[model samples]
Target: MADKRDYYEILELGKNASEDEIKKAYRKLARQYHPDVNKAADAETKFKEVKEAYDVLSDSGKRATYDQYGHVDPNQGFGGGGAGDFSGGFGDIFDMFFGGGGGRRDPNAPQRGNDLQYTMTIEFKEAIFGKETEITIPRTESCDTCHGSGAKPGTKPETCSVCKGSGQQEVVQNTPFGRMVNRRACTNCSGSGRIIKDKCGTCHGAGKVKRQRKINVRIPAGVDEGAQIRLSGEGEAGQRGGPAGDLYIVIRVKSHEFFEREGDDIYCEVPLTFAQAALGDEIEIPTLTEKVKLKIPAGTQTGTYFRLKGKGVPRLRGYGQGDQHVKVTVVTPTNLTEDQKELLRQFAGVAGESTSEHHESIFEKMKRAFRGD
Candidate 1:
């Protein structure tokens, strides 16, 4: 007892420190020395010591005992609560940590199940529209062999003599706080207030079994990569007779060979022959649904843009659809024959080679505007 470090020294606070000050010091030290956050060799031991210090100092009754006697007895309820301070009302904290294990939880309560997530990869076109998918997930279900009671078939579970089927036990201790009542879950019956003398051969003793279940998921339109679709009540079965949780389907859209997307808009590059660009041509272009004829204007140059309204992805949340923007690239004829070269040379000699006099490029337009032409 004498070899133990003073609780105040462990928290780096003085004996005259207030309750709030002690709480702040303890929280800071707890966060700094917590085993999960700090990987030092002594972190876990330091965390336990810090928790012990906070447990005593946070309680007015235990702190008084420690101040006078220099040590608070563990068996006398010194470090029972710091994190477990249920002074306001026991209902909130009691339900959280113990899941209402203290003489409260009904044997047939409907506890909520766990939430699950599954990643799915889909085609680019399917994301632009939508797709119906079925996935399989592993879940925990109540054992059919024992009917969730963990007892063998044809034999009922015996009543627990420890808690007398009430699932609770009263613990009375005398400390500086006077006589205190601390009720806990019965250990022998595991707070169920029932003893399974005969276990199910299939399940051994566990009341649940792991099962693979198939679930249907609906992927909405315009759902991008990393989008999540939630299916309610599709997760693991809850403990006892609880309700099922939600299942989240995370989307992974595959890359498209022809198109790229940004927010609501779609962009694509299409190649056009120089003659088809110069003289207007009705070209076949691919849309989400079908190939359509796109009319290219006469004298259309490279980098010309065309818009197909409502031809891209459908809106995921709003009223209308997005437009597809196509950039035209006029491909020059490659590997020209001698006759083709001679024809081009003769045509260039007669024609005005300047783009401003012919079909003006974007750069030429910009220069003309800048020079006030």
Candidate 2:
């Protein structure tokens, strides 16, 4: 057999590296040397080497055994004449750190799936009132033929010989202190303890395929632009029986022509004639629901606000509705006719020295200011 290589040298990790650091290194190297992506002449062999290094460094018990033995074969009998076996009790440790390796795989195992994001535009009114919409997303789904197992029907997986079904390998080293031991996951099985001899023809052993799927989502009321709604278990399906991720729907609300909304309140500008401001009158004002008559008090000034109670948008999660605020702007008539000017001159003569209750009150203030009081 070829000379056995040092695990730390294979993984390029320090002897004192933590478990988390070892895992991080493994993930980085695995992604780089995975057979599906890397096609170099020795990429597969390098990948297996990295995996083996990680298997030893990630386990505590196996690392302890290897530390005491310095390449002393673990299969050799210990003390007595019985066959030496260091593989026992490793299953519990594996299960504690990396879950179990039972024939029935776990559905929550981490796996990569295409991330999906959807942009949906809605009318302002529709966003406030809420609506149901259907969307079609093109993505990868679990393979139907293999049922996410990546194995052909009637064929079962075989134990990984490299790790002897322990999902890891032990390595012993002679150091200055004495001997050091380490245990790393088997590169051949990716810590799965088994490998598929025959892959599903449909998925090519990936257990997933690319396709488009349609899903319906219900948007709640009071949603705003840039708001995100998460649809759980609706994203692309995971590979190898892993659980699916989530889908995010980003909301974009169109601008409104008549009203602007702030939180639950609605605002609008209304124009009022000079006559309406000078003389108290009941004028129809537009609201979200319908037009309502509002009384404009005599001597009403421009930029005055009139509130219509409970006329704005409904609260999304609360009990009460918001109020509608109407801002009034006075519009003065321009380009009077000659007849109207003459009539206004005649009327001015009669109205010159006389002040009504509303006009007198304002004129008194001006007079006082002129006197510098």
lDDT of 2: 0.71
Q: What is the alpha-carbon lDDT of model 1 when measured against the actual structure?
A: 0.76
Candidate with maximal lDDT: 1
170-254 in candidate 2: lDDT tens per residue? 6665432234344656688887677888999998876788887899999987777788999988888875556687899999989
Cα shift from native, residue 61, model 1 (Å) = 11
Residue-level lDDT of model 1, residues 284-359, one tens digit each, is 8887777878999989977789999988888899978899889988765678899976776566556755433467
**Clash number for each model:** 0, 10
Top TM-score: which candidate number?
1
